[model samples]
Target: MSDADTARRALALLDLTDLADVATADGARDLCRRAVSGPVPVAAVCLWPRFVAVARQALGDSPVRIATVVNFPEGDTPIAPAIRETEEALEAGADEIDFVLPWRAVLAGQLTTAGAMIRNVKMRCGDKLLKVILESGEYPDLDKVRVASELAIAAGADFIKTSTGKTARSASIPAARAMLGVIGMTARPIGLKPSGGIRTLADAKSYLALADAMMGPDWATPATFRFGASGLYTALIEEIGGAAPGAPPRGSY
Candidate 1:
């Protein structure tokens, strides 16, 4: 596919879970409702462990998968517990799992611990999709990011995500440039989701553009690219419809 085609495909993989909201499913479904009825249809709804069912019920066979976070905003848990969380999340009806690598372990040079956690979760989840959030803004080095991306992919992460959407900063094209390079090295078609604080349609387009430029035509589309935004879909709808005739009202799912 052409680069432009790839970009369009990448643009479709966005999910707008709340930035700082509780991980419960009701809050997630509320957000999902707003996003789906808006201009851009989110491919998934992400929430906490207790509410994956709520998201599943709310989204109900819309083809928008239910997503849950594991070891969540803080990636500090040990391997066994994280894996246990994965099991509970799956039972709760999660179609995808987003986990953060333990920064402390990585900083202490425990690459083995960081890697093993992801590998174990993947093994337990089986065919379920796993997204390993890099939390790039907190880490001080790109080398660590590179290592995390590589290890996560090798360990079976379906996507190498940029942030948990809880940090002060969100996804950066430059950071994405680096991760995408690593992701591009693999043939299994890993995804890149530059989530957090991307509140405008233009920002979404920018990430899409960067992914197209970095990963070539194969990386375009929801399967290989994703965005985890919260309130950003509201702006996307307004922007998409303002230029056209008869647009729907702005929403808050």
Candidate 2:
């Protein structure tokens, strides 16, 4: 298969409705329904741990996967609590969990400590997919982005995401490239999420391009890439030549 074909397949496997920042159950359901109803086959509805049940219940028998956030934007939680949060979310019907790696842990230069925390959470969840949020937009340099991605992958994340949409800046091509480089060099079959500020088809397509450019054609598929956004898909759908109904704009954190 060609690079474009591989990238297209990867795009199809993505959980495009990553409204993880949606703060309420009703809002989550609305986005979940919007996600499921769209022309694209969204892999999942990503949300806060508090609403995993709401999304799972709302999605019912649909093919969409149910995912929830762990420590969220800050990634400041203690390890024990973070692990507990993962378990709670799993019990609530989350098939995937995205954890924000502790910025303090990474900043204090406790990279291994952060990885170990993620490892424990992965252990607790077993086969459930885990996407570790690097929150690259807040880091001091691209090296931090590189280090964190390696740490998260080493810590056992099934994927390494670029940001928490709660941050002022979200995923960028530089950050995505930094993460993908490490994953490719290691030949680690992990996922990537270029999330946060992505709001239009252009933003999504650019990130998709970054995936192809950075990870090469073969690994750019949906199984390896995701977009974490609040109101991105609606505009993306419209831009992609579809008359898909829109989701209400994100109102709060």
Candidate 3:
């Protein structure tokens, strides 16, 4: 495909994210406005939980979904609070929940806690999409990464994401390959979201190509695949034709 075609496809799979600590209502509104203003709108807008309502209101019936994080960059919180956060985000009109997997517990051999957390949140998530972030860079090895992926999928995550973007080593090709391997083995319909440090079109294409090689060409649609990124949007914008008007500064997460 030409660069423009590749970019258009990438744009459709993007989750234009703004999870910065300083992110405000005006920022969320601005993101929402810019997201839909483009010729091809992105799949969703991923942001802090508190801004879900603002994004939802700003989007105002556009196809762009609202996604918010819970147990966020730190996944140490117990299940109850995470569930409460999920409930509140849903109430605030978030269409998707990206919850940080309790990787600390998983690494410590508290596998059951990780599974239980996912199950509890899955119950509350109901039909809404639930993305479980493994924070892959923290895992010492690929085997642990696959183990975490299985636990999340078994516990009912609609998508298994690679990172929270706050970690020094957020997303990587090897880690994404392992996650995609796990997803390909499952009969259930699960998705892959390789987030963090995916800035350029080439970076986005690497993840997209790996998904095609591992899963199947038809598998990585907006429903089955997404790029959890902020910097990528501007790159896609450039690829599509022009830069977004009033583009927000891209952040690490």
Candidate 4:
């Protein structure tokens, strides 16, 4: 594909994010503005739960969906609190929930606990989309990543996200490949999101290419694929020949 076409496709699949510790209502509004200013509207804006309402009001009736993180960068939040968090975010008009799967629990061989957490939060989410963050960077090997991906998919995650962008390591191509392998095996229509460290058109193209090679060229649509990053918007805007509002606010993805 030409650069313009690639940028346009990537832009449509982006989850323009602002999960920075310093995020504010004004910042959320600004992110929302950027979301619509692009050549094509982004699939969603992923922000902290507190700003779900702010994003909702800012986005108005725009097609850009509002997504908020539950259990967050750290996946240690108890199942009960995670469910409550999902409830409140949905009440605040969040159309999607990007939840942190308890990776540590999975690493410790507590698959049941981790699975239950996903299942419970998904129940709370009801008809809304749920993107489960695996924090794959923390895994010891691709095997572990595959195991976690299987658990999340079986437990009803609408999408399996790669990282939280808060750790020493974030999303990587190898990690994404392993996750996609699992996604391809499933009969369910699960999606893949490779977040963090993806800040340029080249990075976006690489991931898009991988998804196409693994799942087929037509598989990576806004509904089935997403690039979750804040800084990536700038690169896409530059490629598409539009003035970016400004540098995207610093964020943990």
Candidate 5:
């Protein structure tokens, strides 16, 4: 594909994220400002729960959605806090909830906890989107990653995500391949998000190509696929148009 085609695809599916530890109200406002101010608009902005309202207010009347993380990068929170966090984020105006799947429990062979946690959040999520973060890197092997993907989907995850962008290992082709395999087999309309360490146009294209190869060219869209990154929008804007002077700085979730 040409740079234009790739850039278009990347920009349309991008989730402008700002989950940094030092994130302030001003920074959240700035992130929202940049999302709408960009050359091409992104699908959503993923923020911490506290900033969901800030983002919602900053993005008033815009088509851009607001997403927030729960159980976040650790994936080890108890079920109560996790569900409460999801509820609070939704009440705070998050359009979507990205809940970590408690992979540590899955790693210990406790599949029931993983399923119950997702089901609990999904119940509260109602019609709102729920993307389960598999934290694929924490799994010992690709097979484990695939199992986690399946568990999340069966438990009612609208999307299965790769990483939290806070791990020693974030998104990888092999891990994403495993998750995509699960997504392709499921009869339900589950999405895929390959996040973390994906900060370049080339990085975004690699995952987009993988999705196209596995799920057909037109399958990945704003609804079915997303790149969760804080720095990638800059590169995409530069590639799609020219310089991106207003692009926000890189951060994590």
Candidate 6:
């Protein structure tokens, strides 16, 4: 595909994010505005749970969905608190819940603990989309990545995300391949989200191309795939030949 075509495709699949520690209501509003101002609307505006209502009001009936994080950056939040966070975010109008899976539990061979958290949070999510952050980069290898992916899927994650972007490493192609391989084997529909450090159209194309290769060319609709990014939106807009909006402060994806 041409750069313009790739940009448009990535734009539609983007989860325009603002998880910065310093994020404010004004910042959330600006993110919402950018989400809809582009050539095509992003799939969602991902923000801190506190700003879900702010984003909802800013978007005001726009087709763009609202996404918020829980147990974010760090996945160690206990199940009870995570559930409460999910409940609160849902009540505040979030359309999707991106929960950071307790990957440390997975690494410690406590798969049951990780799985329980996903299952409990998913129960609260109900019909809402639940994207579990595997924090794949923290795993020792791709094999561990696949293990976490399977656990998340079996535990009822609608999507398995690559990272929280808070660690020394974030999304990587090997980690993504492992996650996608697991997703492909499932009879149930599950999605993949490659977040963090994906800041260019070329970066977006690499993942899109990989998805097409592994899952078939028609597999990556917004519901099935997403690029969790902030800086990437500007690169996509530039590729689409428009004056890009002011880039927002960088945030961990």
Per candidate, the number of residue pairs that clash is 7, 2, 0, 0, 0, 0
Which is better, 4 or 6, measured by lDDT? 4
Residue-level error in angstroms, candidate 4, position 2: 0.8
Q: Which 10-residue window of candidate 2 scores lowest in summed lDDT?
A: 2-11
Candidate number that wins on lDDT, 3 or 4: 4
| Sliding window of 10 residues with minimal summed lDDT for model 6 | 244-253
CA lDDT of each prediction against the hidden true structure: 0.72, 0.76, 0.90, 0.93, 0.89, 0.92
How many backbone overlaps does candidate 6 show? 0
Candidate 3 per-residue lDDT over residues 41-92, each given as its tens digit: 9999999989998888899989999999999889988778899999999999
Ranking by lDDT: 4, 6, 3, 5, 2, 1
* Model 3 clashing residue pairs (backbone): none
lDDT of 4: 0.93
Better of 1 and 6 by lDDT: 6
Expressed as tens digits, the lDDT of each residue in 116-213 for candidate 2 is 89999999879989999888988899999998988888888999988777778778898988888888877558988887777665666677777777
lDDT of 5 by residue, 1-253 (tens): 8886798779889888988888888888888887877777889999889999889899999999999999987888888998899999999999999999889899889999789999999999999999999888777899999889999999999999999988888899999999999888999899999998998888988898899999999999999999999788888888878676565654673
User: What TM-scores do the predictions have?
Assistant: 0.86, 0.89, 0.98, 0.98, 0.97, 0.98
TM-score computed on alpha carbons, candidate 2: 0.89
RMSD in angstroms, all models?
4.2, 3.1, 0.9, 0.8, 1.2, 0.8
Residue runs of model 5 more than 4 Å from their true location after superposition: 245-247
Q: Is candidate 1 or candidate 4 better by TM-score?
A: 4
Best by lDDT: 4
Give the Å shift of residue 114 in candidate 4: 0.5
lDDT of 1 at 210: 80
**Comparing candidate 2 with candidate 4, which one achieves the higher TM-score?**
4
